[model samples]
Target: MTDARRASGKNHYLWGDHCDGWRLIDGPDLSLREERIPPGCAETPHVHHVARQIFYVLAGELTIQLPGRTVVAAAGEAVEIAPGQPHLVRNVGNQDLRLLLVSSPDTAGDRHAAEPPGLP
Candidate 1:
C-alpha cells in the first residue's frame, strides 16, 4: 500500500533564504514539491535543460519574472515555465506564499543558473 504524503510529514529542505520545500513525490520522470516563500523573498533566476515546471498557487501570491514578462498568480492560479526559459520566483505580498511545484522529467542535475535579461 502506498502512503499519503503531506508537507508537514514529508522530507523537508530549505532553500533561497527563509524558503521551505517539502518533497511530496520524487521520481526520475516526475516530481512534486510544496514550497513556501516568506514575504519579500525570491529565488535566483534559473533554467532547466530538459524539465518543464508548473507553479500552482495554494495560498498568498506569486510573482514570477520571465524573459520579458511578469506573471502574478494568486490562489487557485498556475503558471508554466518551459525548459530553457529563464525565470525567477518571488513573494511580493505581505503574507507568505505557498505553492506546489511540479516538474516533468525531474529537475535534478538539469538546472542551470541564469541571468535574466534587463534587470539586476
Candidate 2:
C-alpha cells in the first residue's frame, strides 16, 4: 500500500492477521506465499488490493468466510478469493492448519502490519 520497500527473512510474512499466518516468496507479476492457520485461530473480515488469491490446503481444516457464506476447505482442496471481496479465515480443526496461499499480481497482501518483529 506504500511506496516503501519491504523485506523479510526465511519464513517471512508477505502479511496476515490473528487468524492467519504467511511466508513470502520470490517472483514478479505473481507473488508466492506459504500460509498457515494454527489451531483455535481466526480473523475478522478483510480485503486484498488487487491479486486474486487461492488457498490450497496442505493439512488440517480451514473455515473460510465469504460474503454471507462460510466454506470448509479440507486437505488437498482449495478455495479462491476474488479481488475486492471481503473475507476471513478460521481454523476449525483439532490440528494445526497448513496451506499454500498463492497470490498473483502481488497485490493481495497490501494489508497494514500491526505487529513488529519479536512480538508474541
TM-score per candidate, chains pooled: 0.90, 0.70
Residue-by-residue lDDT tens digits, candidate 1, 1-120: 122344346487889998888888999999999898999999998999899999999999999998878889999999999988899999989999989999998999998999963442
Root-mean-square deviation of every model: 4.0, 9.5
Show model 1 residue runs off by greater than 4 Å: 1-10, 117-120
lDDT of each: 0.89, 0.67
lDDT of 1: 0.89
Clashing pairs in 1: none
Clashing pairs in 2: 19-42
**Model 2 lDDT tens row, 28-67:** 5776666656787776466776768898988899888776
Worst 10 residues of 2 by lDDT: 111-120
Off by over 4 Å in 2: 1-9, 14-24, 112-120
lDDT for 60 in candidate 1 is: 99
